[model samples]
Target: MADKSTNNIELKVLVDKESNKVIFIEPENDFVDVLFSFMTIPMGTIIRLARKHSDPVVIGCMNNLYASVENIDEQKFWIDICKDMLLHPCNAADHHCNLLKLKLDDAEPRRYFMCWYTSSCKFLSYDRNTSSPCHGGVMDREKSLRLDPSQVGNVFVKGEIRFTVTDDLQVIPPIASTNYVFTKLDVMDVDATEELTINIGTVEMLNLLMTSLVSKTPLTETLLKPKQEPKLSSSKIINQAIHIESQMFGDPMDGDEEGKISVKLVVSKSKKMVCYAEAGEDFVSLLFSFLTLPLGFILKNMKDGSLRGCISHLYKTIRDLDGQYMISNHHNEMILDPKLVPGFCYKNSLLGIEETSYYLVNNMLTTDRSLISTEPSQLKVIGKKDDSALGFLKGPAMFVVTDNLVVRPISRILELHILKDLNVPVTDIEDQIVHVGKKEALHLLLSSFLCDSVLTNTFVADLREPKQEQ
Candidate 1:
C-alpha cells in the first residue's frame, strides 16, 4: 500500500528548540519536483490563486512595477508604503453598486474628462471596440478634452466629484490606429518584385546573376582575382636589353647550299653601344643559348640540367668547328625559328616582352647599301725619315667570335696577352710604306691585312710578327 508519505508535502519548523539547529522535512514532494511542476504549466494556463497570504498580490504587483530590485525584502517596504495613495478624496460615492459611463461633447480640441469611478478607482480610457481600445474613442464628438487638474478629485480617495472646467489638459481627441492600411504588404507581393525578369540572355547569365544576388559577389571579384603573375625569364631579360631589332638574313654567298643568319649582339650596356653580326655557324651556337628561355611563364619550370644535354646534342653535329657552328640542316637559320616570333606582347609582373623579327633577305637584298666613295688624291713624294714611328695595329683589336671583319679602336687594350696564351700564328713580313694624299696609306693597308681572312686568330695584330723568320 503506497501512502501519502511517498511524495506529498513538506513542512519545516526548522529551528531546534534547545540547540537551535534547524532541519527541513518533506511530507509529500521534493523541492526540485515542486519547482519543475510550477515551471511546466502549459503557456496561457489560467492560474487562479486565492490571496495566498494576503500581501502577496500587492507584493507581486509591486515586483512587476519595480524590477530593479531583486530581494523581496528590499522592495517589500514599497508594497506597504504605496498604500498612502489609497486615500480617496471622498469617503463614499453617490452610487455604490451601479455602473458609470462617459460620453463626449463637441469641443474644438477634444478632451476627455475623468468620467466615473467608485471608491477612488483610477480612470483608464477604453473605447468599446475591444482590440486595443485603451485610447478612448467616444462616439459623436468633435474632440475629447483632457481632465483639468482642478477636477483631479483625489484619485486615490472615494468621491463623486465633478467640475465644469474652463481649460483642457493633454489628451488626444481620437486615438491613432495601430493596424496597417490594406496595400502591398503581403509576403508574396514583396517577393515577386525581388524576382528577376527573365526575357533575354541565357541560363548562364541568369545563374550568374542569381549567384551574385545570393552571395553578394561582384564580377571584379571573380574576373579580377589576383592573377598568378608570370616572372621574367633570363632570356626575356636579355631580350629586353636588345632594342633596335634587325631582321635575320640568309647566306648571300653565290653558290652556298645554306642560308646565313645575321644578328647583332650588343656588347655593352653603356651609352656608346657597340654591335657586331656573324655570318654562319658561330652565330648558330650563340643563338642556341639565347633561344633557350622564352616568356617566363612558358618555360619557367624547365630545369637548367636540360640545357647541357641540349647543347651536347648540338655539338655532335658541328664537330667542334671554329668558324662555323655546325648544324644538321644547313638550310636552317639560327634563332630564326617561327616559335621565336612573339605572337603577343607579354605583360607580366616582372617585365614585359616584345620582340620583332622579320626576314630582311626576302624583302630587299639587291639594293646597294654602301656609303658613296670619292677618288683618291695624289701628294708630293718626300724622303722623310721618321725617328719615332708606331707599328700597325698599335693596340689590341676586339672581334666577335665570328668570321665578320669588324675592328674596334682600342681606347685601351686588355692587359693580359691572350695571343701568347692561346698560341696564335706568327707572321714574317717587312713594313712597307706608300704615300697618299690626306691618308696614311701604310696604316690603311696594314689595318685591312690584320682583319684579312688569312689571319686565323680573332685578334692577330697584337701578336708581334715573329722576328722575320731568321
Candidate 2:
C-alpha cells in the first residue's frame, strides 16, 4: 500500500544500462490504479493541470485552443458558467479518482446545488445562482451525493495482483521469467541491466502524462532522462498527413444537414495548404467543446491509435483486462465508454456525445426553518428546457481560426496583418467552403492531438501533389 500521508509512491523499475532505457516497471495496486485513472481526466483538466506543473507539457495545438477560451471576453458567452464549464470540466469517475493515493488532477469535485425554498423543488443547478423552475429561491444550497459505502474503495483494478507495465504504457500480467522478457526485447546481455526504485509524486505523474501523449518510450523519457525537443521530419509529417486524410475522408459521413457547420478555408495556392479558416460562433463553440470531453471518450471514438500517443496503450490495457480483475463491470464500462459531466454537452456539438444523468434525493432545504423529516425520494434532476443560447459563444459574430487552431474575433485589419505575416501575395490566396459534420469533427479531434497542422492534415492533404520518383 502507498503511504497516504505523502504524495510520493514507490515503484520498482527495470532499466537497460546499455541503452539507458526503462525496460519495464512492476507496480502495486495503488500505483496501477493511479495510472489507470488517467483515462477519467478531461482534456481541459489535463491542459489546466499541465500548465500548473513546474515543467509544463504542451499538447499539440490544444494549448492554443485552451488559450482561445481564456482570451475570449466573459460577455461573449451566454452565461458565465459556460466559460467555467469549458475551463474546469468535471470528470465522470471523480469519486473513484478521489480515492487514489496520488491525486493528480486539481479540479474540484462536482458540487450539487438545490433550490432553497422547499425540499420538494424538482429543479437542480450546477451553478449556485441559477433560478429554479418552481419559482423557488436561488439554488445556493449544497448537497452531498449519496454514495454506496461498499463501492467507496472499489477502484480500477483488483488488489494483491502482480502486473508488468512496459515503457510505452502497456499493462500486462506477470511474465513467466526475466530471461523471456530480455529475449522478447532482443537484449542478449543480462549484465547490461540495472534495477532502480523510483519515488513517484505529483510532478513525476504529470511528466508521465505529458510523455504518454508524445513519446513511445514514455517511462524512459519521463523517469530516466529529461525530455528532448520533438522533431517531426518532412517524410513523417507527410505520412501523418496522409493517414489523417484517409481517416477523415474514408469513413461514411452522417447525412444530417442541421448538424453541419460551414467553414471557409483560406488556402495558399503556392503551398497548396490551408492558411486559416473563417467561421461563425457555432464553429468556434464546436472547437471549444473538444476540451470538455473525457480522455476515455476521445480514445474510444478515435480510429485505433490514430492519435499518436502511448496513452492508447494504457486505454487498451483497461479495455482488454479480464472482468474478474476489475472492481465491477460498471467500473470497466466507466473507463471504456465514459460519458461527459452533466450539462457539459453543447447543442451544436457534432460528436453526438451525451452527458451523464444525475439523480438526487430532494429532501435538503436551505432556509432557516425547521428541518423536514420526510422520507427521501430519488428524483432525476430536470434538464434545461430552453434553447435560447445552446452554446458558450454568443452567435451572429465571425471568428478566425488559424491552422493550429488559434481562435479570435474576425477583423479585416487582423486578416490583412496575418496575410502580411504569411508574406503571401493577395492574388495567391483563395477561399474554399468546407462542410464539417460528425465525421469532420472526429477528424479534427484526432488531428488536434497528434499534429500542429490540423487544418492542412485534415482538409488540404488531398490537394498536395504526390512525391515524384526519387
Candidate 3:
C-alpha cells in the first residue's frame, strides 16, 4: 500500500546544496504534467509562490524537469528567469527550464534555473553561456512608469484597474477636441457732419499739385507742414469750403437688409473768390488720378486756363521782368541787313538768326558768267574774283535764319499776342525769353504748347464776359 502511494507521486527532483544544480529526478515521473500546469499560471503568482518557500521548487514539462531557487547567492539568476517568463509565457510542448548535464571538471557551481521558452531551453545560471530570447518581446514597463523624483507630484491616477478587458491591459485617455467662434459687429447709428474751410493762394495750390505729381508719397503726408499765415494778397487767395455729412437709417443688429448708409459732400467757393470746385467721390477719385501724371505734364497743364482760372490770375500777379535782354550779334560777326527788317525783334534784336561764312562757286548758282576778259586765263581770274565777292555778300545776308537762335523756336508773335491779352508786362516777356535761353528749350515748349492749345480751344467771348449766373 505504501509503494502504490509512492508510485502516485510523479517525480522527485533533488538539488545539491554545494553545486546548486538539480542532481536527480525519476525517469518515469509525471514532472512534465506538473510543469505544463504551471504554464497557465501568471509569472507574478509563480514568483510569489517561489518567494514563500525557501526550498527549491521542482517544475517539469514535456519529459523535462527543472528546479527553481530563491537563493540570495543566485538572486540575479532567479530574477532574470522570472522576467523572461513574464515577457514570454512558456508553452506546454517547449519548456525553457531544463536540468543541464553535470560535468566533473566544471569550475563554477551550476545553478538550477528556468526562463520563458524561446527556440530552446535557456538556463538562467551565469555559467550557462546562453542568451535569453525574451528580450525582443519584453515590454519596457520601467520606461512607462512615472517613477522619477521630479514626476512624483505630476503623476495622475487616471482610472480604476480593469481585469475583464480582453484587448487592452492599459488604457490611455484621448486628447480633447476644441471649437472656436469669431464675431464681427458693424456701426448702425451714424450722424456725422464735418465742415472745412481752406483759403490757399494759387501758388500754394500749384506747389501742392506739383508735390503730389512728383512724389510717390501720399498727399496727406506731404502736406503735414505747420500752418503758416497767408503771404498772398486777399485778391489772389481762393476760398474753398468742404461740407460732408453721413447718416445711417436703420439698426445694424436687425440685419444687413435693414441697415442703410447715406453720404453727402458739398464743395463750393466763397463769395469773395471765384474758385472752381468739384464734389462727390467720383470727382475726388478723378482728382487723385491727376497725381499719376508726369510732373512736366502737370506743370504744362497748370499754365493753361483749362485746369483752374485761379492759375491764370496767379501767373499775372507773380509775373516780373526786372532784368532781361536779347542778343544782338552772333559769335561769327554776321549782321542783319538793314533792307530786310525782321517781323519780330526784342530790345532791337531779331528773334531768330545764326551767322556763318562759306565760299560758293559761280557755276552752282548760274550756268553762265560774263567775265571782263575773253582770254582763258583772264576769264578764270575774273570768275574767281566774282565768286569771292558773291561769297562775302552772302555771308552777312539775313534770310529769316531759324537754326542756332538765342531765342526758342516758338512763335514770338504768338507769345506776344498771348502776353498782351493777359495784360503781362513787355519786360516779363523779355525776362521769360532770357529764362528760356538759360534753361532747356523743351521745358519752355511744353508750357507754351499746352497754353496755346488751351487758349485756342477756349472761347474768346467767354473769357471776355462773365457768365449770367455768376
Candidate 4:
C-alpha cells in the first residue's frame, strides 16, 4: 500500500478530488466463523423491523471479568487483544460493548438475547501503509479487521440487559446518570468524531465480525414497538438516550443461514421544544410548533430532541417550505436541514391542466431512485378483482396522459424500461397521437406499463360503465 499523497496534481494536496484506494489486506480476511468454530453466539434469532425499540438482551458479562486470564485463556487473550489492538474479539474493548457489559434485571432463562452488534460505517483516515482503501476484509485466516458493512456478526438474541462502563478513555461530555447518554450531555450521542488508536485494517476486520453477529431474527411490527407510552419530553428523552445502547445476548440458532438485522437505537441533539411534523403537511404548523418556543431558550438549551428526517406524514403549505423538508445529506450539528421534497396524491387533483410536476415518494421501494418522464397522454391500469371477487386489489394511483385523460396504477419502472428498450428519450409531453389517433400512444404506454402481457393489434374494448336507463 502506498500513501494517497503520492497523487500530485499541480502544487495542491488533491485529497478531496483524488479517490482513496487501499492496496492490500491480509489474514485471509474471513470474518464469519468457520463451521463448528466455537465462535461467540449471535445466530438463530430473527430481528425483523425498523425504527424500533425494545428491552436489551442481558448476559452476565460481569462473569467475563471473573473468567479472565486464568480461566478462559483464548477468551482472555482476545479480550486483552481487543483492549490493546481494539476490535480484537473479546479483548481490551469488552467493557465498551453493549452486549457483554449489561446487567440482567429480569428472571427469564439464559436462553437467547436481543442485543446485536453493529459498527460505525466504513471509517477512512490517512494511513501511512495504503494508497487506496478498497481492500475487502473477509477471509478464513487471520480474521484481523472486519470492516464490511454487509457482513453479519455473532447473534445474541432474547437476553436481558446488563451494562458496565469504565472510568477511563475520558468520556467526552462525561457520563450522565447510571445508564443514559443524553443529547444535552453530548453532541455525539447520535454521531461522533474522534481519533481511535488502532490499525485501520484491524478496525475494519472487527467491524465486519461485529456486524455479522448482529441478530437476524424475525421481528414483526408488534415486536418492533414498545408496549410503553410514546412521546417523551425533552428531559425524559435525554435521560433515556444513554442507556439505549445495549451489549451482549445469547445466540439460539435455527436451520436458516440468513436472518434479520435489528435497527440500532440512537438519540441525537435537539431543541428544548421539539416539534414533529409529517411530509406534505402545513409549514406554519411546524414553524409555530417549533419556532413559537423562545429562540433564546431553545438555542440556550442547545440539545434536547432530534429532528426526524422524512417523517412521511409531514406536509408543507408552500414549495419553499417543502424544500426545507428534504435535506437527508446532513451537514451540521446545531441544526438539521431536511431535503426538499413535496408529496402528491392524484386523487386530490394536485396536478393542474398541464405540465404540473410532483414528487412521488414511496414509503417502500428504496433502490434505483430516478427521474420519470411521461407524455401528457394518460394510461389507465385497472386492478383485477380477486378470484372470490370479495374486494379489488388496492393498486397504485392514476397518471395523467392528457389534460382531461387519466389512468390508474401507472408503473414508474415501466416508463424507464421502455426508454431503455426503445433506445431514445421521451421528448414531448403532448402526444401527436391525441385526437389525431390515440391508438399508437396508448399502445406504447400500456405495453410499457404492463410487462409480459402481449397485446394483439393494440385494440382496447370500450367497457365504460354507462348510466342505467330510466
Candidate with maximal lDDT: 2
**Alpha-carbon TM-score of each model against the true structure:** 0.13, 0.83, 0.12, 0.14
Arranged by TM-score, best first: 2, 4, 1, 3
Residue lDDT tens for model 3, 171-201: 1112211111001111121222111222333
lDDT agreement with native, every candidate: 0.19, 0.72, 0.20, 0.18
Q: Write the per-residue lDDT of candidate 2 for residues 1-470, one digit (tens) a residue.
A: 23345678788998999889998898888888888888878899988987865656667677789999999898888777778878888887786788887888776776677776545666666667677778656778877654433454446776577788889998876644867766766667768888999887776776788778767888898788866524322233332322323322234544645668888889898977777889998888888988988888777765354334578788877677755677666567667777776567766677888765544434532211112244434333443423446677877889989888999999877778777888877899999777787777877876676557778767775633222212
Task: Tell me which residue pairs clash in candidate 2.
Answer: none
Instruction: List candidate 2 stretches off by more than 4 Å.
Output: 1-5, 53-55, 115-122, 127-142, 146-154, 174-190, 228-256, 306-308, 360-388, 461-470
On TM-score, the candidate that comes out on top is 2
- Find the 10 residues in a row with the least total lDDT in model 1: 164-173
- Scored by lDDT, model 1 comes in at 0.19
lDDT of 1 by residue, 167-233 (tens): 0100111121212211211222222322111111122222222122112221211122212212111
